[model samples]
Target: MVSETVSVSVPGNVDLAGDLEVPPSSRGVVLFAHGSGSSRHSPRNRAVAEALRRNGWGTLLMDLLTEDEERSDALSGQFRFDIELLGERTAIAVDWLAKHPSTSGLPVHVFGASTGAAAALVAAAERPDRVVSVVSRGGRPDLAGGAVGRVRVPVLLLVGGRDEHVLDLNRKAAEELPETHRVQVVPGASHLFEEPGALEQVAAAARDWFLQSAGSGPG
Candidate 1:
């Protein structure tokens, strides 16, 4: 496998920092969209990315915000909830992946966490031809608003059984998703899935979902 830090240039001359890792023979690439106030360096996301890599899938963990923007957001917490902007950036990253030498020909998948789930949906809606599937880990996909109904790809919404409110939200969001979508609850886990073995279950579920939905055509 090969891993490197990359800078993805988006609109407005913005560059998002990322860590891209591709296995010797990858089935596809999974782009990770972190949740509220998180970045590519998030430990949870890094753990998940490692799991995907072990399964022969490439992974890209990126910070959707610029360093300066992130600094500003740290105080106001404004940009984290800007779903529209986040989605736009995610879509732009998809375009960057298409041109990158390593991931150009691979099928693209999105793994979203928390609010990032909504951004993933919007990205899928915006670039149906590029994204093959989406997976939300304790995500607020409802935040994607109308974009939820527009995503044609198979989506897997993973929620913690103990997180009643978020689970309910996921159920509602699942209804608007394509027929191939589903909501899988990880019993005993909370929002963070910090309990022993909880994160492993999440990684397993995501790996299985990506493998199963890979053959499905574009969203």
Candidate 2:
């Protein structure tokens, strides 16, 4: 296993901090785009990353915003909903992953949470060749706007069963996506999947989808 802290440079002369981990004989790399107000250290994302690593995958958990931007967003709630900026930054991170020595040429998957899910979809649409698949957790894919229609890769939309509104949103987004898409509901869970075993279910489903996309899942 190889683990390191990395700095990813995006547009606008900003640097984002990330934690990268690659298992020996990695199958691929999954880039995590955390939701509004979340950071690279998101416990839920970290848990999922750990699961992916244990299964011979590389994971990159990056903060979509710089420290200064985070502080400002915290005060004024200005940047959290900037889906365009978030999407651009996420796409640029994919470029960074493509060029990085450790992750270069590796198939890339995107895991997005909350508003970050919209950004993830945008990134997938923008970098069709670089991103192999995408998984969104309790995400607002509707916020991705028209970019949702342009995504060519497989997409998995995971919503908590009880997160009714978001579930509906995912359904609507799925309608606009390409045929290779699924909207999966996690039963007995809420928006955050705070119930015991709920998050584990998410991690498992994500693992399956990513592996399947990489053609490494069960026959």
Q: Which candidate achieves the best TM-score against the true structure? A: 1
Judged by whole-model lDDT over C-alpha atoms, candidate 1 comes out at 0.92
Displacement of residue 46 (Cα, Å) in model 1 is 0.6
When summed lDDT is taken over every stretch of 10 residues in candidate 2, the lowest stretch is 210-219
Compose the digit string of candidate 1's lDDT tens values, residues 1-219: 678999988878888999999998899999999998889998988999999899999999999998889899999998989999999999988888898989999999999999999999999999999999999999999999999989989899999989999999999989998658989999999998898998899999999999998888675
Instruction: Tell me the lDDT of model 1 at 85.
Output: 95
The collision pairs in model 2 are none
**10, model 2: CA deviation in Å?**
1.6
lDDT of 2 by residue, 77-186 (tens): 89999999999999999999999888996889999999999999999999987898999999999999999999988899999999999999999999999748999999
Q: Give the TM-score of candidate 2.
A: 0.97
Clashing pairs in 1: none
Give model 1's TM-score versus the native structure.
0.97
Error of 1 at 105 (Å): 0.8
Q: All models: lDDT?
A: 0.92, 0.92
Runs of candidate 1 with Cα error greater than 4 angstroms are: none
